[model samples]
Target: MFKKFSPSTDISGQTPVKSSMQRAIRSSILSSWNIDAETLEAIWPKKESIIHVKCREHISIYTLHNEPLFFQHFDGPVYPTLRLLHKYPFILPHVGIDRGAIRFLLAGANMMCPGLTSKGGRLPPQDAALPAGTPVAIDAEGKEFAVGIGLTTIGTEEMKKINKDVAVESVTYVGDELWAVQKL
Candidate 1:
């Protein structure tokens, strides 16, 4: 979806997020993520209000001090920018892709099941299975930081069973246009 994202042409307006909405977001974030209060405050301070940066195609970027933290496409789950995921690695569940698939992912290709089900790839165990459409941090084999953020197209067990098709739909990656916009 962000294959050709150009901020200048895509952004429509910037507005200060309202306090009520801020509380809603704050609580929603707190409830949705596994982060502690201290960590959440450090990322989004109570004193600094979040800026709602509107873009084309119903994309809403939430920022603080001009640095993009997370974004939402339409009303979908909030996806932390790759930068944010790098800082607080445990906020979301993870799905790892093999080294061979890193190049394809960097090129903005959707992840196929083989890349994630192979020896190098990693997925949650059956006991910790995640449902479809869950937000996930995509890690690379032997990498400390996540390479991308995406939504699971199917359950982990399903991916293991059906290993030929797309597994995770890439939302944002390390070299995508969204990753380039660190500020504004």
Candidate 2:
């Protein structure tokens, strides 16, 4: 399920997002991740401004104090940035993968089912009931770091039955443009 990805060069239209819009975004994060309002407040203090960045036709990125926080897709849920993942890995559901699959995922490959069902992989029992398209963090075996965020292609029961197919579609990873965009 991996595809070759080329980075984008356009940064043409960026402006400060409104407070009203920021509130909606905050609400979306709270409800989607099951996080409390206080936690959200702490992560995103009132002093920081949330910027709306249009990277392309359907891709919009939100940044807090100039650090990328989420990428909103026109047709999907907003995905937390890798910076957010590194700071708060437990904030999202997790899917563990074997060490061998780490390189592929970093290269923007969609996570294969076998990687999650293999010997070194483990999926939490609580995540078994989560619906497809739920955002999740990816962790490699024996590593304390989260590699990226992905959308589930199937629920756990179906995932357990399959040996080959795309399990998680990579939205953003360590080396993707979303990650690199942070430095600019």
Candidate 3:
């Protein structure tokens, strides 16, 4: 989504979020992700204010102190920015791809089932199976940090069974335009 993004042109305006909206966003994030109250507070303190960065393509990036924290595409699932994910690695579920697919992913390609079901790819076990449209962090094999953030196009088990076609749709990657914008 951020492949050709230009901050200067794409960003429409920046405004501080209302207190009521802040409470709603906090509650929404708390319920969707597996994070504790203390950790959330640490990332976004009660005193510090949040900025709503309106960009092209219906992208709404929420920032704390000018750093992009999370974003939403229309009303779809809220995604933690890659930087935010790096700081709080456990905020979202992880899916690993083999070294062979790293180059493709870096080019902003959607994750394929074969790459995920192969020897190098890793997916959550059936006990923790995730449904389609869930946000996830895409990790590279043997890498310590996630390379990208994406949403599941199909369930984890389905990816394993089908073993073909797209599994996850890439949203933001390491070298994408969004990552280049550290502060907004």
lDDT of 2 by residue, 1-184 (tens): 1132223455556799888888888788888985777777888876687888776557777777777677777857878788887887778888899988999898888999899989988776754566788898999999988888899988765777876899898888777766766643
User: Can you write out model 1's per-residue Cα lDDT over 10-102, one digit (the tens) per residue?
Assistant: 999999999998898888788777788899999998999999999999999999999999899998888888899898999999999999999
Tell me how many clashing residue pairs each candidate has. Answer: 0, 0, 0
Prediction 1 global C-alpha lDDT: 0.92
Model 2 scores a C-alpha lDDT of 0.78
lDDT, candidate 2, at 44: 86
- Candidate 3 residue runs with Cα over 4 Å from true position: none
C-alpha RMSD of each candidate structure in angstroms: 1.0, 2.6, 0.8
Task: Give candidate 2's TM-score.
Answer: 0.89
Candidate 3 or 1, higher lDDT = 3
Residue by residue across 104-153, what tens digits does model 3's lDDT show? Answer: 99998999999999999999999999999999999999999999999999
Clashing pairs in 1: none
Error of 2 at 30 (Å): 0.5
Stretches of candidate 1 off by over 4 Å are none
TM-score to true structure, per model: 0.97, 0.89, 0.98
Best by TM-score: 3
